[model samples]
Every structure is written in C-alpha cells, then in structure tokens.
Target: MRAGVCVILAMGALATMPWAAADCNPPMRPPANQRKFASQAVDSIIASYQPKFKDAQLGQIFANALPNTLDTTVFEHTTSGELAPDTFIITGDITAMWLRDSANQVAPYMRFVSQDSGLFSLISGLVRRQARQVLVDPYANAHQLEGSPPSPHTDDSTSTPAFAGTRVGAMGPTIFERKFEIDTLANFLHLSASFFAAAGKDQPTFGAPVNAAGQTWADAAELVIDTLRTQQASSEEEGGNPPYLFQRTTSQPTDSLQFGRGAPAARTGMIKTGFRPSDDAHTLPFNIPGNAYVVVALREAAAVLSALGRADTAASALALADEVNAGILAFGVVNHPGANGTVLAYEVDGYGNSYFMDDANLPSLLGIPVYGWTNTTDPLYMRTRALLLSKANPYYFSGSVGQGTGGPHDGLDRIWPMSMVARASTALSDQEVLSVLEQLKGSTACTGLMHESINKNSAGSYTRPWFAWANSFFGGLILDLAETRPHLIFA
Candidate 1:
C-alpha cells in the first residue's frame, strides 16, 4: 500500500534489533479463502510496513507487534486443536479466553475484516461464544472452552446467583470466574455490536448473535435486563436480596462481605458490581464508572435490538439504560476538592460517601468518553479527566518514563498501559496525544511488547510481561494516530 510513498527509516535499537518471533512458524491455514487471505494479512501486515516506516521506531513498534502479538503462537483452534477458522483465542500467559480480553485483543484487527472473511467469522465466533457464556451465567466475566475444566479464581468470591426470570437453555463449561462486574456485560454487548457491524458489511447474510439455544440477540438483551434488575434488588426492593456470598479462608485480606452477600447497595436504579474491573472487591457495592458504562451498554443493546424489530424489548432496554444514565447524573457525580468541581466518583453507596479516584480499567472516569458514555469535552468529564492524570488522584503515578492512572490490581505507584491508552484516546490536544505516544514508545523495557503496567519513573521496570491486551491496545493507539493525527506522527 505504501508503493507510492517515500518511506523513512527508524533510528534506534528498535530498527536494528530483529523481531525474535517475527513470522508465523507453519503459516496460517484456513479452508475458506477469506480466512487464508486474512491469515496472510495478519502474519505480514507489520513487515508490509517495514519499507514505509523504515526510520520510524514508533511505526516499527506498531508494525512489529500488531499481528505477532496475537498470532497462532498465542492462540490456536481449541476445539479442533489446530490453526484455522473460528478458533477460540486465548489471552497471553493463560489458556482461557476472557470475555473482556478477547474482545479488546481482536478489536484493532477488525479494520482488516472487510478484506478477509476468516477474521470476520473468527470475531463472529468470539461474540457468539460470549453471548452463550452470558446465558450460562451473566455474572461470569471469564470462561473455559467447551469440555474444558473451570479455571480457578483462587476461588475468591461467589456471585449473586442469576435470576432465572428469562433464563435460556443448557450448554458449555460453567464459567472461569463468577465475580460480576458491569463491565463484563458491557464488554460482551459492545463486542456483539462491533462484530455484527463489521461482518455484515461484506456478508449481507450475516445475522445478529444468538446463544446455543435458538435465542436471538434480543433474548440476550432481555437476559441483561432481567439480571440487572435482579442484581439491584434488595430486602426492601421487589426481588429481595440476591443470595450471593463469598468467604475465603485465605490470608489475602479479602472483602468477605456479609457472609458473601454484599452490603445492600440501596436499590439505586444503578447496577452494583460485585467486584471492580480490577477484580478487586468493591469498597462499596455501587461502582460509579460501571454504572455509567451500563447506560452505554444498554443503549447499544437498545439500538441493536430495535434494528432487529424487537420494539418492545428495545424500549425496555432503553428505559433501563435511561434509568442508569439518570442514576449516574444524580448519585454518581459529586464535588471533589482534587478536581475543584463536580466529577464522577469511582464508587458510591446511595448514601453520601464515595471514592473520588479512578481505576486504570474501563468504566474508569478517564475512559468515560472513550467508551461513548460521555463526551470528552463535557466540563465534568474534562475536570475529572484532569484530576485522574494528576497527582491528586491517589493511584495516578509519575515516574521517570510516564504518568497515568493505575489501580489496586497493580499496587501503588504503578501505571497501566491501559490507562495511558484511555488517556490518549480522550486527549484534548495533539501535543497531549503526542506526549503519551512518546511516553509509551520506550516504555516496554526492551521486551518489544507492552506490559500491564510500567514504572512511571523508569521505562524498563514493569509487570505482566505477557499481557496481550496492552500490546494490542498500543497497536490500536498507533492506528488511531495514523488515521486521526498523522501530522502528530511527524512531530
């Protein structure tokens, strides 16, 4: 594609240091022509850019990691035990596919789907598999492939049982982890719409996702509605308290909530998360960012279901979405001295108290605009975003190499590449985005891949060496800049 463009050469160890695992071993093989076409594209998109980005190390970083980071080396066909179409993808450093991770990992590559059918089908399978798992237990955030054993969660928490109001039929392994977070449902819904839109572009016959049972995506939407309503119920509310309890004998100082049943979150109309996206127990049942996310998720559900002619169901979902949105505007936004204005709280009890800081994860205040939950230019979000990136936010870290949000998941003074990506995605200025790119370009510590978190003070010191999500996120940012801020690329 760079056939006519004058290519520049990158200057650094990145240019000279050959990629250790640059190409696929046996090459990707798929029975379908589309899959084979995509296979070659996935395996060679980076190398194809080599001449075009000859002198640009950042470009080299994007080129080298986009495909290699998610190739057959890390993911193989789990059902057939080979590399081919619709194979389940595993997150790096683990064998199970997470509803959240799998979606984000394959997100950046969807741009190539119009050119390759295998990729479209593969992503379609991921969405369907996720929809199937939601039916299994809407509370489960991660799951194992069919016939595979349940992956242990250190067996920390037991979720509030899913109410069988509109439960769908039997199928699949139980679930890898059942600790519920609103983001899990949001992630699945977002992925469904994202895949459907992309795949349907080239394949006119492509239909909306349905679970193992012959249920449509609308049925899945109803499941979300019923489950969310049930989860929000309490002793005073219509459905009585959800009978979920988690008591671990470990010395991990877990959040052993009221014999595992969480404190009644007071029926705020806003959904409560059993755990944060960080996988840590919530200080309070009502999570601010998560509630904001539900508004987005349900709206997505509403839009999709409406298109499918499920009028009543779509209205029901939209009503619930509005309830959550109103809930966020009312209870979630509060004054914070750190931000010097009203901003979204991280977590809150319908009671007065709330945590003002943000986590590095989605539903995070910093990621609000990125998820389409809020406008990045909105005053409150802008103020909240400012505080999140500053020292005022307790988890906000500033070290030698970079500075951004972190979370309990990574410990103190650590910054997640995830947070950096969110920040860049919502950045107000070309300078701001470029600064983030500069911080990330050299933050990998010579792994030539991204890490879950890196030392803010030292670019090399980091954790989670095999985090596939962060690597893909970095690649996504590279793509974003190339599309939206190519001039920034020169600066």
Candidate 2:
C-alpha cells in the first residue's frame, strides 16, 4: 500500500522492462548481520538448494522466504536462568503472536529438530509458551507478547452470551484478539504433537508446569478438549445463544457477527465457530474444514497425552475425534449438483443448508488431504477439489497474473499465495507442483517474497508485504519440494 511497495509491484508486472527486471529480482533479503535469528540446519538446506533451482527468480524468492521468519520475526529466545527457556515469535508487521501463525511459522523446522539442539530449544520453547497462553484463555486466537500493549479488539463484549448455563470465561490483557476460532486450539495441539514426534523423546518433559498455579501441558490439552466439547452445542440447544459471543463496532460486515451471535446452527455434534481461520465471521455455523482439522488435532492431542502417560485423557480425545468425524460424514458431505457427485461442503447448518465455496485459508476444504482429514486420492475429495478449483467455487479466481483461492477477507479478484502453497503441497504429481511454482514465481511482483494476497490481474498490487507466516510457509514448501521432488526444483 505504500508508494515504494506499489512501485515495486508495478515493476514486477513488466517482465521485459529492463528497470523492472532489475528492480523486482535484485537480492531482497537483509544482510546476514541484520538477521534477527540464525539456524545452521535451515541455512544448510537453503545453501544446498539455491544452486539446484532451475528458475533463478524462484530460487531467489525461496532463499528470501525460507529464512524470512528467522531473519525478521524471532522476537525472544531466552535459553536459561528463567522459569523455563522459551521463545516468542511475532507475526510480520504485527507484534502479537497468533496461536496458528507462530506454530506454522516454525513447523517446517520440525524435521531438523534432532539435528540441532538450539533449534530444538527454540521450538520447544514455543510449545511451552503456547501451553501457557492456552491456559490463559483457550478461546482467544492470538496473544500479546509479554508486556506488550493491549489488543485493538479488547473492547469487544467477550463474556458468555445471554443463555449459556456456565461462563465461557473473560478475556485477559494478554489476549490480542478474542476471535473464537476452532483451528486456534487445533493448531496448538498440532504444534505439540509435531514437536513430540520430531523430538522422539519418551520422557514427559513438555508436561512440566508452565504456570504458578501448577498447570501442566496436559492440563492445557484438557482445557482445549473441554472448550471444543462445550462449543459443540447448537445455538437453539443453548436457548438461542451459544456460549461464546463477540461483538465489535466495525463497519466491515465480516468484522462483527450479527446481534453478537453468529448465524444459527442446530446441534450437529460438530463444534460451531464464531470465526474462520481467516478471522472472518462464518456465513454458516459449522465450518467443515475447521471440523476436519479438529478431528485430526484431537487425534494428535490423544497421541501427545498417551506419550505423556495420560491414558484417560488420551481416550477422551480419541472419543471426541470420532464423534466429530461422524458428524462431518453425516452432515458435511452432500450430493452436489454442481460437482455431479457426493462432495464435501465448505460450511453447513444442521437444517440442510451447505455453503459450497472454499476459502484460501489453511483449514480450507481444498486442504483436506494436506490436513490429513482424508487421503489425497479419496474419491469424494478429488471430486470436491475439482469443483473448488474451477469456476464452481466463487472464491476461485483466474486472471492475467495468476490464479488461486482468495476469500472475502481480502476482497474480490485477489489470489492468496498460501492457497497456492496448499495446492502445491497437496499436488499429486510433479507437473501440478511445477504449475503452482510458476504462478508463485510470477506473483511476487519482484519482491522475492510472498504476500498475503495479490491482485489476479496485476501481480504488483498486493497486501501485507511483511507477513511472516506466508513467507516462512512458502519457504517450507520449497524445502519439502527440494527433498521429495528435487526434479522439479532442479529443472
């Protein structure tokens, strides 16, 4: 949106223009001395893969992106002489740490955890920080870094809604935003499980107390499960009011829910959410992709608990996962006339209403395979994916610059690079992956970094130049391709 960003985007659009060519692709990363953090494991891979890239532009972009999180966002990494060694990572251009973004920002580094003890501590510290934040407020999606200023959305009426029997709880000063997204808790479980799996440790070190109240990691997991279970109730079942209510005095329709409660839904066993992963209010109460993510996250939580020697908590997680999965199959799957087969709906109400479009967010319907909710080659998923990628899905946009899914949060005719990453990450073949890479290469508008959203017709017009999650995730995707499909990167 700044003049400098706009000029860079304009130059990126003119591929053959000599000044544009020089402006868009010049080494865009900060100098080594200026980087905020460093990792030998990540640098080793980046150094190894840079020369292997056939497209020099793509290579440059990958180099800048893969280290973007470390170079720009590592705010705190206290190693010793404290209650516990922990890390705090800020979202790019924003000081707050989102439960989902911070986890994903470091997730790609999980594979290298054992190879680097420093990296292990960095990630483990995040796990510890996330546990403490979860206990602080399970319903809030993002938290302020220690001693950071209050969140802009703190004034919203976050108390339990009128008809609920018990209090859902109040928002604390540590919370940056109180948007009640189901994926927030799911991502917390995912980070814990992924770290546990990668570290390969038998001891329950992560279960140690993180708060003065003596709440352990296992205690936070129990709270996540309890919150999800409580949200499973329908608005009508709760006497026309769900337990959580968030009302903001904003002009943007997507920013606030109607009457401080979301659209109505019936008791469908699946958890109802006030907001989607994109932080937009849902048109329907039940978000199918979100529920699918919960199913996987619940199982992952079960694995974490079982590893920590809590069999009873593990059983509860597994049982809840099964119940949610059943609800998904029963109500979320519908015979779509547009897709000409039984396919997964994006959002559904228990009264037989289903929203057909998929947003570009992580817990998207198109990300079912990547999220491990269903196999990549599952018949239903394939059909649903086909419909989603085509004109059938309203959010699926195609223009002169490139094409991918974008949601209402960014407005019409913009494509999200995260959606492109999702598509490439789930690509069944090398050619499919290559196609997305080409689009991504051309979409950066010469900044050599990923943007939150780009104009489909003009690559240079984009948003959020400093978004760390997209940059790091794009880097992670390239790392994955370098290992599994080197042919594409090397070509």
Q: Which prediction has the highest TM-score against the true structure?
A: 2
Question: Which clashing pairs does model 2 show?
Answer: 9-460
Residue-level lDDT tens digits of model 2 in 1-491: 11122335453353443323655555776898998888899889888888888887788888888888889998888877443667888888888889999998998889998998878888888898999999998888888876777777777777764333655446788888888899999999999999999988663447667777888889999999999999888787777445677888877888788877789888888999999999999999899999999999999989889978889999999999999999999999998888777999999988899999999878899888877999888999999989999998999999876679999888889889999999998889888998999888877777788888888877778888888888888888888788788888886
How high a TM-score does candidate 2 get? 0.94
Poorest lDDT segment (10 consecutive residues) of candidate 2: 1-10
Clash number for every model?
12, 1
- List CA RMSD, all candidates: 7.6, 2.6
Point to the candidate with the largest lDDT.
2
lDDT of 1: 0.67
Candidate 1 deviant stretches above 4 angstroms? 1-55, 72-87, 154-173, 201-212, 234-243, 254-258
